[model samples]
Target: MKIAILGDSLVAISTAHSLLDQETDAEVHLFTERPEIGLMNEGPGIFEKWPPCPNHWISDLKSQEPSEGSNSVRRSWFEKAIAIALSERGCIIHLRTRCTDVSSVHVEVKGAGRIGSGRIPFDIVSDMRSVSETSTEWSGGVCITGGEPKLEITGNRSDGTTELWWSGPRKDTGSWLQEMKWIGEDPRESLTSEIKVGIEIARTLVDTIIQKSPGHKIE
Candidate 1:
């Protein structure tokens, strides 16, 4: 199986790729904006603590880095093509982004005659109580954090394919979101435990794709 994991950072893509590698004969390629793909962080608990790439890595390897660096990050042709073919089977893990842009909202009536809302953060239309259904449509892919903003890719559903990604509000916004950072792990250990877990996850996802589409090679 040929598998592609697209994300904002190396750790996420690695995690997704590793998961597939564990369960299948799939060849996993990781695409990220970080310059240091396949570069090892020689320290303790590096996998558990995914740290931001060092400044030197970014300056030197900027060109080869995943387009995720600039707005070009959104232009993930590999990820998009594979995601289209796999549809829901393909997964994208958004980093330091927001989920609002990727999903839809629905209003539900709760008890006590109260009106409640649900959030659709991922490809699936997960219901969310949107702040403003008409105003905050999330059509514009803008990541908001601490009043700092950046342009991002908005999710679109067409022709029965769903692009998979994730994000959340700012830290101050008090929403539970996954945050990526770096830590140290024993480089001499040869193979850290987290890498093993990541490979397993990637392999499992490959199996799912294969089972769903037996005619196609889901690598």
Candidate 2:
């Protein structure tokens, strides 16, 4: 089966990661407009006594040589690690690629770095992009305490400083929201739940895609 995972957030990263762990032979393609991940201001547990990123896809986040301010790991570095790992795992990673149009069977993209602009075909096309309507934009930290991604919430934090990705089915066919980052009244408290919720939703979204895939047999 040819599967396409779209988006540029942790959920998208986790989806591609989990899809591969299924051990199926489906050809997986991941596309994002970001020239690279972690370019945004992602917070961290990078300096915590226990550094995270040890589970699945996030585990691919490698610890590079300690830099001048080795206090906390940069989200840019952390995210890039996962992308590299996904590429090594046989996922056709397309950076600087943006999907102009999407349907149930294919995605029209203008891509670079690894893919030229073209319409890519797929047996199943999963839209992981955050298409929800929200005015909130957040810059938060991320950690890899260890577990798969999932989602069970549908709203944002109280402060409006952050917005959590709603993994629920999007009313529109062109988009589905599934990102993981935010801050609330107590940013720390909200952060913890955000990761948990993010993981759950990402897992649910991808699992649904895999089960519905034409060639994959779900037992």
Best by lDDT: 2
Give each model a TM-score.
Answer: 0.27, 0.59
RMSD for each of the candidates: 18.1, 11.9
Residue runs of model 1 more than 4 Å from their true location after superposition: 7-29, 38-42, 45-191, 214-219
CA deviation > 4 Å runs, candidate 2: 44-72, 131-219
Model 1, residue 17: C-alpha shift (Å): 6.5
Kindly report which residue pairs in candidate 2 clash with one another: 38-76, 43-141, 149-199, 149-200, 150-199, 150-200, 150-201, 151-200, 151-201
* lDDT score for candidate 2 against the true structure: 0.55
TM-score of 2: 0.59
Worst 10-residue lDDT window, candidate 1: 42-51
lDDT (Cα, tens digit) per residue for candidate 1, span 67-162: 321221212332232223222234332222232232222212211111122231221122111222222211122122223232232222222222
lDDT of 2 by residue, 1-219 (tens): 677888766556666766676635768888888777665644332332223333445444334433443434344555676767778789888888989999989999997765588888887787878753454434332223222123322222112222223322322322222233542333233323334444565466567766776798866
